[model samples]
Target chain A: MSATHDATHDEAPIAARVRHVEALLEQRGWLAPGEVDERIDALAAGGSPANGAAIVARAWVDPGFRARLLADANTAIGELGLSMAGGLQEQQLIVVANGPDEHHVVVCTLCSCYPIALLGPSPGWYKSEAYRSRVVREPRAVLREFGLELPASTRITVWDASAESRYMVLPRRPAGTDDLDEGRLAALVTRKGLIGTAAV
Target chain B: MPDRFAAGDRVRTGTVDPPHHTRLPRYARGVCGEVVATAGHHPLADERARGLPSTPRAVYCVRFAAHDLFGEGDHAVVVELFEDYLEPAEREVRR
Candidate 1:
């Protein structure tokens, strides 16, 4: 009898339950009538890696801009008239630079806290417990596994962004691109590069 | 609006195992490190999460040696920590 009753439902149970939640929120004035649609629109347009790429490209071409970015990342990024502000999580963005002998990588051991506003959604591997646990303890081995083998002489510095200030790595510019413009340079910057897993 | 810690200042994370909302990560508790940069003050998200007023607190980027937290390696790890979660560690103080 119960099986027959379940099969007779016109709508899927999950869909019906969601509709019930929507109706209740609207009825209780907890959510304005079209708020759901507005949020969907906002989420769709947020978190693009192109934003971080552009910032990195500009820093590469202009030394002064790089200085400003290193000194105060949030303000320097704001000068571009685009927000580096995390959605619903107002974290301050810190730009870490990679040099000849020094490399920087970012991780949140407790949770996957990252600058989603600029770097876009985190990659699946970055959120894995294996990554969060092992990266800080054995960054060299992890990066090597990720195909970014570094020289023994080079030092790897990991940035654990655990608080209100998020971090992005300003990857050392790759060689043979001296003539490339900002747009071309930005094309080479990948999400992994910004996270310091790989170089640009 | 002044920052409590400046670059090069050595500090230690508080070991307060608060049962409520906190921004400090467990791995960083009581670890001593040098302040690498001053990121100014920001609202405490932990307090805000618990329905309490978020008084702005100074935050700093502190750099810790690999051995300090993980017990091995020559590499370093920098973490962003709030002032309330930190206190001054003993350093070379000249009279």
Candidate 2:
């Protein structure tokens, strides 16, 4: 039980502590030997940004579905048999649309809340204290740091996602992509696009 | 259950600081805003963190102008806050 880790022991302290805790749980019969690894593998595969890309692609092609998605995101998303819920309460998901004159960005001022089911692991900056504090106070400057420089006339809406709901940005469809199929359109969508930090 | 406010109604976030987990961020405390949408009930994350029973409370998307909260900016900020953290923004006595 007191044995040291292998030759490659450069893991971060917090990660090492987590592994140590998991090992203790496994020995105590609390966790099946491989349960932790199995769950992590499943989550990594299941919560990819491609999930959000697929939704965006569908919305770009189908006006009716887009209307429904914007009307009530959780219900509309559930219609596709996809869930956005996590933890104790039903984490309601909201879809905000960006347009020619309007843009939307999401941040969790208090914490790094996000739409993990659709957007996958959030970028480190999105969860940083600098971002969490500055985005709401100085959104344009923050956006500029992300290399997105919107026109002065455009209106930006910064959404502070909280315990009750998560927000996803519906980035505007890029010009000259009208002829592209849904699969091709989806391929062009990036995680940053879904977070309103970049254009598709 | 009836929500404390409806869409278009003016409201303000509360200022009390709970020692436990709270969805209300300090930046939004006491800030005035208007309710744009009503999300259904959910357990209080603050109370749940303390192992106390929390009834479902109505949550709302409150939209505040940048000028109102940050003192400068052209953009707007919308925060999703649960019922307990909100109160009616006292309307001025109309002429």
Give the residue spans of candidate 2 off by over 4 A: A1-15, A78-81, A85-90, B92-95
On a 0 to 1 TM-score scale, where does candidate 1 land against the true structure?
0.87
Please compute DockQ, using alpha carbons, for every candidate against the native two-chain complex: 0.64, 0.75
In the range A1-200, model 1's lDDT, one tens digit per residue, is 35566654645677877888898999999999999999878776887888889999999999999999998888898877657664875667888899999899999887898888766789998899999988888999999998999888898889887776778999988999999999999999999999999987
Q: Which tens-of-lDDT digit does each residue in A30-69 have in candidate 2?
A: 9999999988886776567887888888899999889999
Docking outcome class, model 1: medium
lDDT of 2 by residue, B1-95 (tens): 67778899888788898777888988788888899998778878888989999888888899988887867899999988898898887883221
The stretch of ten residues in a row with the least summed lDDT in candidate 2 chain B is B86-95
Per-residue alpha-carbon lDDT of candidate 1 for residues B14-41, written as tens digits (9 for 90 to 100): 8889988787878778788999987768
